[model samples]
Target: MIEMINIGLPDAIAYRIEGKITEKEMKTVLAIFRKKIKKNEKLIIYQEVVSIGGVEFNAMIEKWKFFLAFGLSHFSRIAVVTHKKWIHKLVDLEGKLFKSIEMRGFSKEEKDQAIEFLS
Candidate 1:
């Protein structure tokens, strides 16, 4: 599941993900991303990934591609809050691939810092 939290900032879009992430959730996120991109060429994304156990591999692959394509071009920065070490490492490696956007991984306790970074 994916839930959006509006911060009332033109460049800020925050989301929390839990349980399984279906195609529907991906589509919803993509729709919001499109709207944000239309409004501002560059934005900031704050994502909290709580769990990935219920998510399917294929779905994740597709969603990852979509994120890389759209997010790389439209977002200036991405702050990911996760307790999972693997996710942190993965995001760190992926961040190296994007030139325009910088990605940072933070622990759950660093949520405030993450938000500040996006702001």
Candidate 2:
């Protein structure tokens, strides 16, 4: 499941992932995000991972499409908080794709640090 995190910030986008993510949910959220974020606007993205059951094939394709069409450069900062090793590595690898963005992975215990880093 994918749940958007609300920190009550206008320029920040955060999501919590529990189980497998579906394409419909992603498209809905992506639409909302795209509408809220203006072109070339700096955005701070947060992914708080509780547990990832994996992503549906269509969902993965949607993600790729979003990145290809919009690009990750719109996000000036991206922070992910997770205890899972694979998730940590995954974020690190994804971060490499956006060298212009300041991306960091924090343990679940360091979620506060992640938020502060984004701030």
Q: For model 1, how does the per-residue alpha-carbon lDDT over 2-117 read when each residue is reduced to its tens digit?
A: 88876455577788889887777777777777887877767688899998648666667767877787656777889999999999998898899775788999999998888787
Note the residue pairs that clash in candidate 1.
Answer: none
Q: Pick the candidate with the highest TM-score.
A: 2
The backbone clash count of each candidate, in order, is 0, 1
lDDT (C-alpha, whole model) for all candidates: 0.81, 0.82
Model 2 residue runs over 4 Å out of place are: none
How many pairs of residues collide in model 2?
Answer: 1
**lDDT of model 1 at position 32:** 76
- Candidate 2 lDDT trough over 10 residues, lowest sum: 32-41
